[model samples]
Target: MTTWLLYGATGYTGKLIAQEAVERGMRPLLAGRSKEKVQPLAEELGLAFRIFELNSQTAEHLEDIDLVLHCAGPFEKTSKPMIHACLKAGVHYLDITGEISVFEYTHSLHEEALQKNIILCSGVGFDVIPTDCTALKLKQALPDAVELALGFDSDSGISPGTMKTMVEGLGGGNTVRKEGQLTDAAIGKHQRLIDFGRGKKSAMAIPWGDVATAYYTTGIPNISAWIPTPKAAIYAARLLNAASPLLSSEKVKQPLLKWVEQGVEGPNQEQRARSAAYIWGQAANADGVIKTCRINTANVYDLTVYGALEVTQRLLTGDYPSGSWTPAALFGPDLLESLPGSGRFEIDSFYPGNAN
Candidate 1:
């Protein structure tokens, strides 16, 4: 039987993934830095549990596991050690990280992973799974496209882990792909009225992982990622860009982190069931030909559970290419279509026909 380990099993999102795994009759070994938390959950799920800090010893625990579903963050700190362990143990690696730096770093290890014949995939969650696939679908609709714009509206509450990750990057501004290079852009640098199938909504450029992953997947030279935000928040982001020095300081960031700690772990089951996410993408060539696509899916957190487990299950079946890969690159855009309650549409345009 293919066995996997669930690191950071006690986290909010980690717990959700664990529950989904159990519901699907999967019994992943629960591992984390804390026995107090992981032990209870493991017992509840009737699975074995292990506790280990991310270090040289991590490989010892991976001896029999085929894959690791790393859910802990901020991945900027957690991913390196775990990745090193996975590579050493010859185990496939996956994570739910939206951090662009994390994606870039993981991609840099493609050769190492290929050498070991172990797949390394990140951003399997709400971060880029939907957006990355949508970007590829748009690229298919416009094969000669040189520029791409992606947008999403997450009508769901933020989890504590997600908030902490966002707080850690407050002063770094946003990121966008220009001429196929990842470059910093001012927060709120670009704004658009994206028609997310529901209606036109205000969206602003953000340092979403797709700014990096989309380019890697499609080879699009210019790309931007956006998220729907209220007008007031957009204005605040503009001002925050000017005050980045202060915002990025520990003195200011500490209180914000504390404030986030007081927030809920994440959305409740009711909220997740009722909420929804909308995504839009457009690819264009120099001649002004454009191809657009839209995706409507369940709530962000809910989709995270499905997306993460779906990828995990697929990895368990064991025939994936060995290298750092984007979700779309590994599974194709039709991967998104397999998710329940997910829908995608491509607009008919005067551009080239669909590549797929």
Candidate 2:
């Protein structure tokens, strides 16, 4: 049997992925820090359950599993421990991590996993898939790109869990790749207004973890990512960024997570309605001429589910990268074709009028 491990199977996003797996007739081994939480989800989904609290015994127990869906995100709490356990078990590992620190940290495990013949990938979610896939697509049209700018905005309601993830990212350390070297960047350093097709809204260079994926996936030297959230959100995040000095205290983050968790009223019928992200790629080839392409998409949180489940399914089929890798490096431009078009992804290419 092709047994799978659904880590954090009880979390918000985890449950959806678990449901998807069960529907496919694959009963993954549901795992979580809490056995009580995992048991019912597995049973309800007609899957097996195993509680693994990131302990040595649990890590060893993870051995022999075909692959793991590392879904318990806000991964600062769960990712590393689970990865170490999966590495020890020699199992393939993947996660929807949107934090650069986690991605960088996972890359640290890449060489080791390769030597051991295991697979590890992060940001298999909306974070980089849309951005990464779109970048590759642009590269297909324009061979060499100097900068890639992504703007994602959603009118759709976000799961509090996803919000907590964002809060964690903002409150966590900040980063960007500069001069071909990885370094830290200030939070909210880049900001402006973005047009999401529907309307115009404020956009902030929120320092998404995608900076890492863009650099590694496309040889593009200059990359920046922005999220266009409502103005209220802008203020809240700015407050968080301004208070970064205090965010380091778990005393602060823990309560903040609790607060965000309380904010989850669940996506409404219209709330889950639709959302999108737009990525702009600017290229400069041998000449100094500049060209641009716009990559836009809708329903991003749902897209996260789509992309992540796609990767998870690939893992089950034994169609995946062998070791630690980013989604772009693993999936390439093909990922764009996989997205539900018309609503999910749209690429518009533009050039300066008379520059030809």
Candidate 3:
């Protein structure tokens, strides 16, 4: 009986989640800014939908909704309004956002969410679920952990929304959680060879959402997030950092944004089926103890659809607590393995002792 809404239900990932919801026999009212896109999909799926822009009047639409799965993003721009509306409407808020700023913004409203008795959980997707869970599991393994490193590599092609988010991030440099605080760092400043159960692949630190969520989830003060990157992309990111100011300008960003809008939607069915994601995480303490773990899962996009629906179903069944939460924190570290095609975390190594 939990009435929920799926916003941005027309986007690539959004559509996937929406379709999966129906296939699971769950009905979530679909919503988006464009009626043309939202209505057609709703009609095709035989589901109800609403069209509304993010504005002062947004909460009015959530009046009857118990939860909102906000799939629209560039969450840096889209999240604030939806969060505000959710708070106003006393609706639990969930989103498939991997943006650090969005995580931090939602975390800032933790008290308000607790007061409203509604949960605000974000990154219920490939973005931070695998990484966040890995972080927590490692922390649980090494209780006194002070440093955390996380990385992932996925073969799934990018969606337009993801590409836009990356284009927008060109100017923000990169960030790491240092001494329990978010600190700016040069993009690709830190590199390491991580064996994500396959082989040693070169990874470079990037501003992943775990930089924000993992800190809250595991209380690890020093955190770094990474992704496998080619030497050329690393060099390009360095150059992009040097030209950060220009990239921040609308004049420079608009064309790139337009290109993304006109380009590929995302991977097709074949690509989704063919792709896979690998994640690696480590936690270490000053005492020289380290715990390393890794997981292999379905394509990032496919996991997003599964993760989002799983979270939605759980919340509807009264499975999580109220307040701002990372996906791992709300569902525990085994959440990733609970999904289809996502296996249990393989504790690859333990320094000086048993991981358990």
Candidate 4:
């Protein structure tokens, strides 16, 4: 009956996940560190609740649960113990984490899950799903893809929790794979101007774990995609990124992150009024035949909810393939092509690399 565990049932994204679990006609084992946080919502949805501490014994917790939907995140902190519990209990698992550190750490467990036949997937949200989908589609369109560029733009608004997480990533060094080798880049240093249809904008190079995974999955030699940002905002981030190193001195990163988190939550009404995300992709082979396209998302955090709903449904009904995997690897090219074209943003492509 897909008796899933709804970990982090109390956060912004977690609530949406809880809502989805109920709509699926399943009473997930709604859980968190405090019964108080999850209980009120559990009552609203007519679902039962269970308290789960970070490192507590879980033999009792895993007794009958078939799988776990780890909605709680900043996965670097919570993934290990919960994963340990699941592995010990022989329960299958899944989560929505987008951090490279977290994904790399989880990727390390590949053999472990394979040995036990447990399914572990990270970035079930906006992190790499749409990006991955588009990348796969390009590969299909171009049989021999040599180098790739993927950009993201969305008119999406992020909630506090997402901001909190993004803030946590600030100034920290992030690595991406290049020519099958690892290269480290700071959060906002690598900036570029991009066109998102709404207007000309700038994007920063953040360590989006997708770069590493996509390279590994598709065998693409060169890859990079710029994230969406208004031109002015891009320059602003460039400035901040320049200062990120200094701000990130071991003693200062946390306080700065805390400040940024507050800004996300308490932005002026105008700041909150406009937000977005957009994804664009490029691919080609030795002949220089390149395919280019874009995916537009209007709201950032909300899409996480939307993508999660789609992925969870796929997971629940077995719509997805079985494996310890990533979003791009799972959803693939065809599904992305099938995504409905909308007014806010469109994922469309053209080929012209050979002409130049």
Every model's TM-score = 0.96, 0.86, 0.97, 0.83
Residue 155 accuracy (lDDT) in model 4: 49
Task: Please give the CA lDDT of all the candidate structures.
Answer: 0.89, 0.70, 0.91, 0.68
Report the lDDT tens digits of candidate 2 across residue range 111-173: 889877888888887776877776666666667666666556556667767778766654554
lDDT of 1: 0.89
Best by lDDT: 3
Worst-scoring 10-residue span by lDDT in model 4: 337-346
Best by TM-score: 3
Q: Candidate 1, clashing residue pairs?
A: none
Give the Cα error of residue 289 in candidate 2, in Å.
3.9
**Candidate 1 TM-score, true structure as reference:** 0.96
RMSD (CA, Å), candidate 2 to true, equals 3.0
Which residue runs does candidate 1 get wrong by more than 4 Å? 350-356
Q: How much is 50 displaced in model 4, in angstroms?
A: 0.9
TM-score of 3: 0.97
How many residue pairs clash in model 3? 0
Candidate 3 C-alpha lDDT tens digits along 1-356 = 67999999999999999989999899999999998899999999999999999998999999999999999999999999999999999999999999999999999999999999999999999988899999989988889999999988888899989998988886888899999999999987788788876888878898999999999999999999988887788878777777888888889888999999887689998999988899899988998887889989999999999998988888988656789999999999989999998988877555566554
Q: What is the C-alpha local distance difference test score of candidate 3?
A: 0.91
